[model samples]
Target: MTKTPPGLPLRDYAALGDGRTVALVAPNGRVDWLPLPNLDSVPVFARILDEETGGSVELVPREAYESSRRYVEKTNVLETTFTTASGVARVTDAMVTGVAGRLPWAEFARRVDGLEGSVEFTWRISPGTMLGTRSPWLDRVGEHTIIRCGQLSMAVVGSDHGPASSDPTSADPAELHGHFATTAGSRHLLVLTATEGEPLRVPDPAKVDEGIDRTIDSWLTWSDEFSYEGPWSEQVQRSALALKLLIHSPTGAIAAAATTSLPENPAGGKNWDYRFAWIRDLAYTAHSLTWFGLREETHAAISWLLRTIREQGPDVLVMYSLGGSTCAGVVEYDVPGWRGIGPVVTGNPAQGQLQLGIYGDLIAISRTYVDDGNLLDVETARLLAKVADKVCDEWRSRDAGMWELEDEQHYTSSKMGCWQALTDAIALADGAHINGDVARWRAERDRIHDWTDEHCWSEDLASYVMHPGSDRLDASVLLHAPSGFDRGERMSSTIDALTRELGAGHLLYRYSGVADEEHTFVACAFWRVSALACVGRHDEAVAAMGALVTQTNDVGLLAETVAAGDGAFWGNLPQGLSHLALINAALMIKDLAPKEAHDDQ
Candidate 1:
């Protein structure tokens, strides 16, 4: 019987999808999390949030077995090999997509193939409705089953996919439930789809097989557009796939992670839902997509941001729902958290905070567009002018830091963002996008920079402080190296001090001043790596990048942070900003590695 994967030090899970929806499959045969129809939809299977009560879809061989798995070439098709005393079995898993000119919002399919000797397999499909609050009642109709909960109706078609046997201890079932035995050269397919109108007729096995073949071909063709040929091409490609999976195809909204409240520190109250789109995520994603030459999705995401910012007004929330809906106040749930983390939250409360850094994020995106030869339209320019006016009016106000801390302070990072806004605004005006006082904007921009250098730096610490008069160092300053600030001896010394003080082996702490007991922020670590490379510290940068790559889960997916000692993952999994940082860091290392090593040689 397929036992729970040997409780080895299994790193976190990797993700795979067909661009429309995502599925988090464990190193074992269980699919831990998946939202139906789209990435932001209420989850249909949510075992990752609450392992015991929440539902999951498991496809396990009915034999004591060992297994290894990976994706099939350039596509997102997951292939696993199960080894048993009898023999071995290989199962290929994928959430099938439309093909042959079919509409994207169609059916989803998973296919299992048997290789080697005869292998018996079992599966369970318990539909979690109302986001794991209630399990749906199942009614068998003809050869199909209908699971109805509230307004959502899910249809499951196929035999040999159901609940586990009642042995309570039997690894192999005598009477199989949703169970089937396949010999050499045998194959099986399972299909799941949703319908709001009248129920559609279920397709036969022949049609399902055709769909599977077409879906595989479609993914292969789509992945061909990825032009990144780096030293670690496979890992980079996989990272790109993980980033793509979080994108909601219909609305162009990218979720922070597939699961929510996964916990920054296991058993801590740092858990927060990341299934919504943050403006910061959109800007970073735009930059990454521009680098990768995926302009269509990037433009769509930026347009989504523009619409959201327009509707939400200049006082934009930090984040919003996929369709631009406001996120309600966070609510605590009774679910047992990951590894016993407490206080799992359902939404993010940082939505309404007054963060001055967003102005810089918008300006950075606008600059990227203009640099890419894609002109910011007159309307976009006008909107940016409005944002700049706000920045000008509130440039001296104290607000939350980039970490979004509660106690308002004169955060150096926010001030730097204000500097970035004015600097980029001057460039936007040069493009004739708006009629603004360019001379005044330039003066204010330089003043902000001068103030940051004068007040935010500390002589004793020898690095930029988190805020004026604060002794703590923040990893966020590592970003200034790439922001094209004065990166001379002072900046280099500051980067080195940060490396020594906050670097937890490879992972870097977000800030040293705060009482935050969370994991080291993975993006900060990458930012430091990039800064090290840029400052001609190639040896340090290479070692840092090596250590960072080692922390990726078995399938090459990275969470927001890694535990300093235990190496357990912390924070949200497959963070977009983190992955974006990884790509940019790789680029920086590539450009600087040779120059520094040669200078020494």
Candidate 2:
């Protein structure tokens, strides 16, 4: 057996999904990160987080080889080609879907095809411990190899295109194994079918293999619906496709990112579980999907978000599960994290923090929905009004800002969010889409605007600062441009200040001091694109957007952060906010307004 490399870089993984759960396939044919049943659930294969006991499906050429991969045109299905000394093999990987949509259970398929000459291969299936639960064990029902982990059961099936070998059930680290060789035009496959608390059903190996093309067709059909033709059009479409993978089709809830604990700082304790749906992300997604005119995901996401917020809210939350549950508790494992960065964790602590910006997120979603020829349901409208009222009452208090920091303060961005929320609420009330105390909402909105101007703006830095105490410039304040807080002299100057303080070439750190501790936030740079266009810097926005799109991996998927110095991916895979920001920024740049009209508000 080839010794496992100490680690695989996050950039080396490609994502595949069925709009249900995501699986990250490493460059060398390893299924490194996948959560069962759902994206936020305990992972079935998570060698990305915990290298040793965190299991993976390993398939690699038996000889020294170099590999390259790309998504099958406009689809999430990945095709990786391995070139060995004597031959070549192509592997197609997908999380298959039925004709109707996502399968009731998860189905992951990997088809191996010989491209030239003949290539030898080996494969193994080792299901790991269920997060904090008992270790998995293998069983056999007829010829199917079933691995049981906690309440879940997975069937690992393979078909031979050559002679094979299998491990005895007594094997400790792995119980299912096979080896084979393929010549030109030859085909073989390995399929995994999983379910929780349901009857185990093993699929015919051929049918599972055929499901790869079926999944491809499904993704192509979905991708064809994207009508966006703009700057970064291909990346925009790919971002749309990547964002589609983060949508939990069963409930229409969008996860912030696919996996957890991938790390914003590899050497520090900044790794987080980003598998839940943040209200901020939902609002951003709803806003971005409008440009593509995708009705299903847009409506489903908006409806799911408001419904979940209504069920669990009077005071809004930062995030909720794809299943709409608000009860997420943090759990840390005793396993080594990515690259021996220990204390890998699940369930973010930020869920319970009072992030005041969620008010803006909810109201921003409502505004976008109504503006797009849609009307808010009466209950949803009422809930939004209640949020407006709460914002009016609580805008004075300090709370966790959009960054979800432990140090609660009246962050300028949070105040601007409150301002945007109340402003949008007044518009909704005037349009009769929602009923709110317009008089109070307007008064509170103006107060927030003036208060932010007086307290948050810094003469020394010539920018709206992170908070009153510090002169640090925050990239999040760039959202003020789209929120219509200011797109004039102050905003333009602030953009220049942020570009100098937080910008790292094409990327930008979240705030001033974070450059040394963490990588640049991917979404922040895209926000700079939108803010630039909003402030009449179209030439710069065009130039900036040109550089930022290349920051994504070759497969066109982005994580939450990127190392400014080396362009390595950080945080979690297929980050929703990053893609949403890309889509929105591209559209903003393409439809940028007359420069004269945007000059100095």
**Root-mean-square deviation per candidate:** 4.0, 3.0
Error of 2 at 550 (Å): 1.4
Question: Which has the greatest TM-score?
Answer: 2
Q: Locate the minimum summed-lDDT window of 10 residues in model 2.
A: 161-170
Give TM per candidate: 0.91, 0.96
lDDT of 2 by residue, 1-601 (tens): 9774477878888998888899999889999888888887888788887777788888899999999999999999999999999899999998989878888889988899999998999887777775546678766677655788888898877687343335554544444677889899999988888998899778888888777888899888988887976456789888988898888999999989998887787675987888889999988888888767898888999999889988897667889988998956889887777887756888889988887888998898889888889988889988988999999988888888988888889888999999999999999899989876799999899999999999999898899999997878789999989889999999999999998988889688899899878899999999999999999888899899999989988899898999888898888888889998888898887777565534522
* TM-score of model number 2: 0.96
Alpha-carbon local distance difference test for all models: 0.73, 0.86
| 1-601 per-residue lDDT for model 1 (tens digits) | 9664222122546566766667777756877777665566556666677666555667787778888987777777777888877667777776766654333443556676667777777776655543446555655567555665545566656533444333325432211237777667777776666643345546565676676677678767767877776555676677777788777676777777766777786548788788888877778777877777887778888888887778877576788887778888887767766655666667787877778877888888888877888877666778888888778878789987677789889988888888888888888888876668778788888888899999999888788888998888888878877776646776788887887788777788888843257778888989988888878777788788877877777677788777788778776677777887888788787766675454653
Off by over 4 Å in 1: 1-12, 100-108, 129-132, 159-177, 195-204, 513-516, 592-601
